[model samples]
Target: MNVAAVLSCALLLAIWGLPWSDWLGHFPAHMIRHMGLVAVVAPLIVLGFPRLADPLALSPLAGAVLEFLVVWGFHLPVLHEAAMASSVVFIIEQALFLIVGLVVWAGCLRTGGLAGAGGLLLTSMHMTLLGALLTLSPRVIYALDHAGALQEQQLGGMLMLAIGTPIYLIAGLWLVARSLEDTKDEMA
Candidate 1:
């Protein structure tokens, strides 16, 4: 609804277009897009459209679990392969990412206390674990339709670790601080 949220929507559109749009062909690029969707763009959209998720009435814990399943399930070899092979599947996968991401972010924003921090911290932990798994795997986990599969996969993992971790960690910490501040103010 605000300027920042509007700009975030534009950024989301830009990410899906142009040179960064080869998600099916480049593993690292795909990871970048994934991180942008779940971490960056989703939060902003929730800010702009807070009521969009109000109807769901999801708790932070429920939202986190739903998001975790959607993200990790799509990364499974079979599902990943299917998405890579078909445009329709890819679209479906991306749409789910955006939707679940919106849900998680909305839950966090609406809760905005220790509970929200916990949800975000949990998400950060799982994302780190997945990134580490992909980064340290001896062989390629997902069969890519391009060259340098192993290297690209590793880069993708690194990208997730680099991008997703810090954003979630910082946001979680920010929420914790805000919660404490509110409590202190109430006590005063």
Candidate 2:
């Protein structure tokens, strides 16, 4: 929607592409880095941009669905495995990430509303659950384990949740605050 949002999406793509490009050999590390770039850095940047302030004003349900897809889809064993497999899988995964990122970014930057808050909360919860799942796993999941970087994969998953949840929560709260402020301003 704006330069910042565009850049955020670009950056996310780049991160997702690293493993496939062979710029990064470790899939788990790449995934972790990608998640960090998207879930953490991207949101903060989008939150600062005024142009993204009313995503719901554009397409409410679409934006919410995208957010859900990004967070929940990444956690699924099938999707995660596909993402770590090959170039084709990487492309699909990145595409999904981009769509999801746009939705979440739109929600955060555009009309700060209940839908925006719900999307942010959902993403945060999913990321937290993902981290917990990784930590609890007896062995690294197929995707990361197959990448031959089990230790890094496990660490990455833990780090994603550790870093991602806080970012999501803070952003969620900020969205909530903005929503309330808007309501108060409207009432006044």
Question: Which candidate comes out best when scored by lDDT?
Answer: 1
lDDT for residue 108 in candidate 2, whole number 0-100: 52
Residue by residue across 1-188, what tens digits does model 1's lDDT show? Answer: 68757977797887677466354347777787788899988888877766665764468799889989999998999998898789999999888988888878888878989999998998999989999998999998987655678888898999999999999999999999999999999999
Alpha-carbon shift of residue 90 in model 2 (angstroms): 0.7
TM-score to true structure, per model:
0.93, 0.69
Which ten-residue region of model 2 has the weakest summed lDDT? 51-60
Write down the RMSD of all candidates, one decimal each: 1.8, 4.4
lDDT of 1 at 146: 57
Relative to the true structure, candidate 2 reaches a TM of: 0.69
For model 1, which pairs clash? Answer: 1-48
How does model 1 score by TM-score? 0.93
Q: Which 10 successive residues of model 1 have the least lDDT summed?
A: 17-26
RMSD to the native, candidate 1? 1.8
lDDT against the true structure, each candidate: 0.85, 0.63
